[model samples]
Every structure is written in structure tokens, then in C-alpha cells.
Target chain A: MEKENIRYSELERLCKEFRKTILKIITEAGSGHPGGSLSVVEILTTLYYLHLNHNPKNPFDDKRDRVVLSKGHSCPALYVILAELGYFDKQELHNLRKVNSILQGHPARVYNGGDEVKFVPGIEVSTGSLGYGLSVAVGMALGFKMDNKQNLVFAICSDGEHQEGSIWEAIMFAGFKQLDNLIEIVDYNKLQQESRIDDSVSLEPLKEKYISFNWQVYEVDGHKISELDTALADAKKYKGKPKVIIAHTVKGKGVSFMENNVDWHGKAPSKELLEQALKELEGK
Target chain B: MVTVLEYKPSREGLGEALLEIADQYPQLVAIGADTANSTSLGKFAKKYPERFVNVGIAEQNAVGIAVGLSLVGKLPVVSTYAMFLAGRCWEEIRQSVCYNYSNVKLVGTHAGLTVGPDGASHQILEDIALMRVLPNMSVIVPSDANEAKVAVKKSLEKVGAVYIRLSREKLPVFTSPEEDFVIGKAKLLREGSDCGIISCGVMVYESLVAAEILEKQGINCRVINMHTVKPIDTEAIINTAKKCKCIVTCEEHQVYGGLGSAVAEVVIKNYPVPQRFVGIKDKFGESGPAEGLMLKYGLKAQHIVETVKEVIKYK
Candidate 1:
């Protein structure tokens, strides 16, 4: 049953809204990783609106595809997407990072009271610590493959997180296992917390590293919805290998002052800066 | 007289138990970090090839993968050397498994000085401390092969994160197959009045041997096999402390944060009693035979006997 194809213009419009909403929440929280969050808006928009086989009403459906946001610092993008998709109330976005709020500073599956914290339905495994989410995705892919389920598992990682040895460990594992059902998208914005990724730890020849690990590597313009769509489709169609899309993106994309600026890696925008960003986003 | 059965490494019990429950729990999956043969998971790997995953030598990925598998409704049992599984992947276990309350079973084989000959690098003395401090983590140190098998089965049946510490050496089979194995309950192996010798893992059998030795010295010692280290048998520890008027904790782990510390946490809060610990006293193990290492590290029955007498004097 072929549904209406998501037009590129529609995805681009959603991306702008996602960026605006992400900036709103992070600015309201008074602190968050804006650069990384802004960089991943288009990738998340395309995945949630088009690629992901999930239902917000049935977030925990056994047959639903899973997405693990490995770079949890960029959770503002995910939180906005989940809210926009009706996984939770849009009002809950305001409570992000507040005490006792389910929207923790980092992604978590439980609150302080020990109850299952489903701040948003699509938030899969809790991840904030770098180098963890990809391994979890690999495990889920293996589980799905073993059960012979057609469901897919996707993980979004930051370029800076590649420095964590555990990420390479998972990459090696996914490659060795030949987990074709897995797709990893690295937001290659070239910047990490406090500095550029190269200044901190270079991941040059990153695509070659994946190729050496037996992964099907794809590089694309991350901001271009068409390229992300095609790369994701190619990843889904390929067999006998896990796929990784090295999306070349500018850190803090779409926001002029924040673009490629490491200063915005974790800092939130002030009220005036937020107004300026909203004006720019709105083309007013 | 206690009739001891044939000796077997506790890791074998874990492997065999997984095989036994393969049919009953179809969702049970075993994962090894390049130590399938060493951890006795090769049998399960061969039997249920599809269900068993060898994540190579990456311990952090093993734990994180287990969390992912658990998230997708599969009960994953991840095993590796205790030093690596607990030490190298400590953050993964905390952030991925425990924080999410994922139903992943962590089996750390070759724990304590029993790893022997491999030296301090292979030995993991702080796993209990490492695991117990995390929320939603159940820690089990089975006394023998039989208890280890039962612990594996029980951990599989239960939901959430669990850490089961097993040994590399083949120890005496003190626990019977018919013994009731509960998660948090401590089994009183022997009853006495002079003092209480509470222990876990391979040290449980040593505590029993210490009890027999103490009997001839006119020091009637009670022996309690505290298998579950976290959510420990607080009632058993307090009752033993109150009855014996003194307590001695014996474990194959370090004195800082293992059975000794677990028992003391229960005793000092509920019933303060004079107690001594028989364990590695902040010293790392060296390359030697398993038996020699146990003696050098003060993990033998004799050490338990000496500590029993020392605590009794305070009583």
C-alpha cells in the first residue's frame, strides 16, 4: 500500500519549524547544546516525517521501527519532533530540564520516582553518555534480524562522539555481524563541545573507517532533504552490511551567527538572540 | 558430614542453565565478549546459534548491545571476564542498562582472585561495589555450581538488570540441586551461637569449612550463604548478628565493597555488633595458583576461622 510520497518542499518546511521549536525549548530551558541540535534538525525531520515506520499513538508498538538518539545532547530536536507528532502534549516541551520534569537534561527512561518515563513515545533507549546509543541500536538490529522481523533500527550520532572508543567497538560489532537492518546517521557538523572536532580529535578518513569495517558508507548534504531521503532508501535496500550516512553539515545550520561557531555548541540563546533567530527563521 | 559433589566452574553452570531454559524461554539470548569458551557459553552458542551473539572482545559494546536486545523484548545474557565487563563497561551498564531498567543479565565470570595466575589485571574485586551502587541493579554471587545455575535461571525469569558473578576455577559443589534458590533470601547453612560467619560466592563453602573447624575449638559458628549481594538478606544478617553477638563476613572479593560491606551495612544500621571481615584487605592479587592465591589473599577457610575468633573476642 503505497502512501502519498512526502514532497521535498514539505520536508524543508518541517525542518524550518523543527529548528524554530528546538531553539524555543533550548532557549526556554536557559541551557542546551544548540549547535548540534540545530545541525540535526533536517535529518530528524526527514526520519520522523518520512522514513521512520512509527505511530505516535502506539509508540511502544512491537512492530514499530526504533530510533536511538545517541547524541542525546541534541535531544531538543527529538523532543520537538515527538511533540509535533502527538507522542505527547506540546505543552510538556516547556518543562524541559526542569526539576521533576520527564524531559530530563539527558535522555532517560525513568524519572526520580522509578516510574517508566515516557516523556515522548518515540524516544527509544535512554542515551546521553557518548558511544552508547549505536551499540544499543546494533543490539536491536540483531534482535530484529534474529526474530526475522522486517522492522529497522536507526541511530543518530554526533561526529564528536566518534572519539569514544565504545562507538568504534559498536561499529566493529555491527560490521562483523552484518546487521543490514541497522542505519547510523552521523551529524558531521565538524564541531564538538568547546571546540571543533578536528581540534579536539580528528575523524578524518571517517568514511574510509566505516568502509574498512565492512559498512556501506554514504555521504550526503545533510541539509538537503532529497539527499537524506535517497541515502536512507539506499541504506534500507542494501543487504549483507550495516549502513552509515556521513551527512556533511554546518554546526548550527540555518542560524547565521551560530553556524560553524563552537561557542554555540552548548550555550542557549538569550531572549534578544532568540527573537533574532525566530525572525531569521520566519524570514520577517 | 556434608557430602560434596564433583567440582565444576560456576561459569559452566551458567552455560548449562541457559541451554536448559532455551525451550522454556524462547526469548533468552546469550552474548559473549570473545570469552564464550572461557565463560562456558560455547555450548549455548552451538545449541542456539541464532540466539547466541559473540560481540568479540568489546565489553562495552556487549553490555550496550544487551540493553538494545532487552529493549526489543529479548532477554539478553551478556558475559565476559569480570574485570572487563564490570570495570571497562561500568558506564555502559549504568547509563544503558540500569538507567533504562533494561532486562539484561550480566554474568561476570572469573571474578575475584580465583582468576589466579592471570594476576590482578584479570581479577575484579570491586564489581559488587560497582554494580550495587546503581539503581535497579540486582547483584548475585552464587555459592557454587548448583547455585550459579539456579541464579542464571532466576535472573532470566526476573525482569530488569542483574549482575551474576561467577568464578573460573572448579569449586566444590556445596549446594544441592533441590535447594530453594530465592533472589534476596540468604540460606543459613549452619546454626550456632558463638559467632556468625556470613559469606557468598566460593567463600560460602569456605565459611562452612570454617564452621566445622571452629566447632572443635569450642567456638560454635553459624554459617549463612548470602548469595544475593544487593537487596541483601538484611533479616538474616541482623538476626545472625543479634544471636551470635558477633559477626564475621567472608568473601572472595575485597573487604571494601563486597559481601563484607553489604553485611556490615545491614548490621550496623539494624543491630550494631562487633564484626571482622575476611577478604582482600586493599591488596591486589598476584600471579599464582588459585589455591595459593586464595591463601595469600586471605580468602581461605582459615582466614574465616581467624576472623571468627577475633570478632568473638569483641563480643
Candidate 2:
């Protein structure tokens, strides 16, 4: 794989911009998941701007690599990058959860009369209910392998989503089938919506769990753009087994008060809180 | 005396249909949730080994994968026992497949009371109700083996989600192999004026037999095969209500949300008519022979005949 021409400084700058925009939208919408959105800023920024082989013009091109945001509540982050990359009009971002908006609260395709009329261009599948997106990604990878295509499928799941039994079910199938084309990146922010993973249901042996299921595991600092870029590039080349990058990140990365806080997991910031959060992100 | 018909499980027709249409639809793929042979998807797996995927007892993953495969231009057919496929993975089917409008075919074998000896745990009496409720999901319960084959093949021709319910028991094969399957088009097997018998799945055979017995008793009954539960043949249902003025719904499922409720919805709205239902009256099925269970659940020909007489009095 060729190196992405963008420098680490440029990627870091975009992460700050993404964090501010994510908080602003959540505040405007009056309800959205901000903690998980802030957690995966660098990971998504690196993938969309640097790593993924996608075109904003031909979003559904057959040769393009696919991405499934399994932890869909953090879609404010995804929506920002997609709009910046011209997947849809940037103005549509304001109508995030409003009725008749194409941007659903979760990642989804708009369907009318049982027909898909419109959808956010970059979103590969409609997902909100956890534990199902990995299976969908595995299916896509298997389909690509069947057709002898080289396109890869990336599935981004939250650490809390690993609690779903279907995630392991998909992992088992991907490993058994030797789907080297499927890469799963877990946003390991430690905290779920109500509490931390340690206080609630603990997924302590998470790394060994994937290895036992025949997956090649890689752990990295999720906020580090270069590390995520490296792991993503290597996972793309690794063969004979599925790959999962456990991305360690804070609940809210740039925001001072919201960082590591469980209450920010799904709550939108008020205007006063939003201004303070944006001030914290201004120079970072 | 009614002649004994050749018996064949509806799952067999599903297998035959896959083989029949495999060459034409080269992108056709079969996915099984560890019950490949039981659901008769083994036939497709045997011939097209590369195209077959056994997800290994994970019904939710099977549905999610089927949706994924559909997104990438493959016609993925996923089958498992009805209880697991429809009951366990209902939300997956709704969100990934139907709500996404993925072109996936879901085949639920061992449906209704015909899945004998497994008891209520394995038999799915609520699949029709469960599947029919989802938007963009077309639910089809074939009357016999031949119609099951047509339903499977025809369902693939369209570009949306479809749920085909098949029975595990070796049922009497009465539907013709030559008949064309049009979705939402009910087949009126016998025309009569005394009363109408609307039925689906294995109970269609029972309804036909019941109509025969009613004819001998000078009470002619109209027997209809209401195969497609969703996108129901409302015209057939309304016309039957007008012609007969009385209706009796027969099904090998719970009387609540299966063919009985569907027919009643159409009848009571379009043309109000007196109707009676012949099915399991909200009870779990116990372990027994298929024939014995049908008798105990009041889903046999005799039960349909009795229900028809009961509804005619209300007319």
C-alpha cells in the first residue's frame, strides 16, 4: 500500500476540527451521542481522509472499499467526515434527528413505501441495534472473496458492542472462512452509555477472546493518527486470518470535562457546555 | 372416499427449486445456520459448494450476512428452522434485510404444527404473523411441495426481501407442478356458493378435502389457497366473501395472526361476512406424531368441515 501524502500534523488538525463540529451538531440537534463520537475522531479521520480507497463522486462504485459503523450512535463523527468529503450537502448536517431528515439518528438508508429512496452516501448499511454490523461486514467480505475481488470491508464497533453474542458469532465465521479482507476496529473507550465496562458487564479478556476465535489481534492508541494508519494499512495486507484493532481511547477525547465521563456517552451538550468544549478544542 | 395422495415434505420442493434456478441465477448463494440438510439447503450446498455458507447455528448472523451478501450484488438465500430463523432473529431480519431493502430470501422450514415431535420449542406457529408484519417483507406459505417450488423460484425474480415458510412433515402433494405462482394471487381450487374456505400451507390440502366432504352433504364450499400471507390477495378474499357470504379460515397455525386474522381483516373491511377460524386456539403444541398433532390441534380436514358448517349458520 502506498503512503497517504497527508502529514501527521494535518491529520491532528482535522481531529480537533472534527471534535468541535461533533459537539456543535449534538448541541444544535439537542440530542445525540457525543462521547463515542469524540472517542473515534482520529481513527475515522485517518481512515476516511488517508486510508480508505473511496471516491465522493462515485460512492457506490463496485471497486470501492466498504465501511460499516457498527457502533452507529457515534454517527455524528461519521456524518462530519462524510459531509466534509462531499458525500452529501454540508447543510443537511443541521437536520440530524429532525423528522424528514435523511440523516437519521443512527446510520441508515431512507426508505419510502418499502423502497430505498435516499440515504447518507458513505453509510454502507443501516445499523443501530448492536451485534449485527460485523456479521454484515463479514458477509460483504465473503462476497468479495467469492467474486475474486480485492476490495476490503471495514467494520467499526464500540467496545460495549462486543458484549453482543452476535459479534462473536460473526468473528467465528470470519476466522473460520479466513476472511483476510474483513477488518474490525473496536472503539475501546472503556465506558458504555450508563457506566464503564469495568463497573457493569466486564469484557476483561477481550484481546485473548478474539485470538481464541482465530483472529489476528492488534491493540493501539486510538487517538494516535499514525498508529491507526499503520494498523489499518497492515491489517489490509495480512492474509489467512481476520484482523481486529482494539483502539484504546477516552470516552470524550478533546473535551476536558467530558473526557472519561459516562454521562456524556449519549447526552448532547447544552449551548453553555458546547461553548466551553469548543474553547478547549480551539488550540488543541 | 378421498384417495391417498403422494406425500412430500415442502422443504423438498425448496431444494428442487434451488437446483432448477441455479444456472440461471449464477449469483445465487445458499446460507444455512447449521441446519442445512434439515432445511433441504444441502442440495444447493452439494452442487455449488463454493456458493454455500453454513453460519453454524447462528440465526442472527445468518440474517445479517444475507443482508451483507445482497448489498454486494449476490442473491443470498438463507434458511433455518422456522422457530430460530423467524423467532430468534426477527429484529435482524427487520432492520438489516427489510428496512435496508436488501435483496435477500429467507426460507423458514419446519414451520407451523407440522414440525412434529420437536414440540412448541421447534415448531414456529407465529412466523407468518411475524414476517408479514415487517414492511418490504413478502410472506409466502406454500400449500404443498409444488407451490413451494414455484414460490421460491418466483420470489427470486423480484428485487426485495421474501420469507418462504415450508413444513417439515411429509404432506399430501396436491398442487400441480404446472401452475404459475403470482405473488398475492390466491388460487380458487373449487368454486362453490354455500361458503368459502380460505386456507394456506399444509391446511390448504385439508380445506380441499373438507370442501369435497361438504359437497357430498349438499353444502358446496369454495376452497382457496391463500398462499401469500403478506401482500395478501385482497381481491380474492373480497370476491369470495361476496360469492359465499360466509367464510371459514383453516391453517396449521395459531388462529390469532395467521391466515385466519389476515382473511378476517380483508373480509370485515371490504365486504362484511360471517367467518369462523379452524386452528390451534392459543396453545403450545406437545410432542406427538404429525397426524396426531394436527388432529389434537383441530387442523385436519374434519375440523375444517366442522368450522365451515359452524360459520354457515351465522350467515
Please give, for residues A95-118, the per-residue lDDT of candidate 1 as tens digits. 899876778787776665435444
lDDT of 1 at B116: 82
B237: Cα error in model 1, Å: 1.3
For all predicted structures, in order, the TM-scores are: 0.97, 0.97
Taken in order, the candidates have interface RMSDs of 0.7, 0.8
What is the lDDT of every predicted structure here? 0.89, 0.90
Any runs in candidate 1 off by more than 4 Å, and if so which? A1-6, A112-120
Q: Candidate 1: deviation at residue B241, Å? A: 1.7
Docking class of 2: high
For B56-165, candidate 1 gives per-residue lDDT tens digits of: 87889899889999998898999999899988989999899988878999999999898888999999888988998988899999988999999999988888889999
Clashing pairs in 2: none
- Where's the lowest-lDDT run of ten residues in candidate 2 chain A? A110-119
Candidate 2 Cα misplacement greater than 4 A, ranges: A1-6, A111-116, B1-5
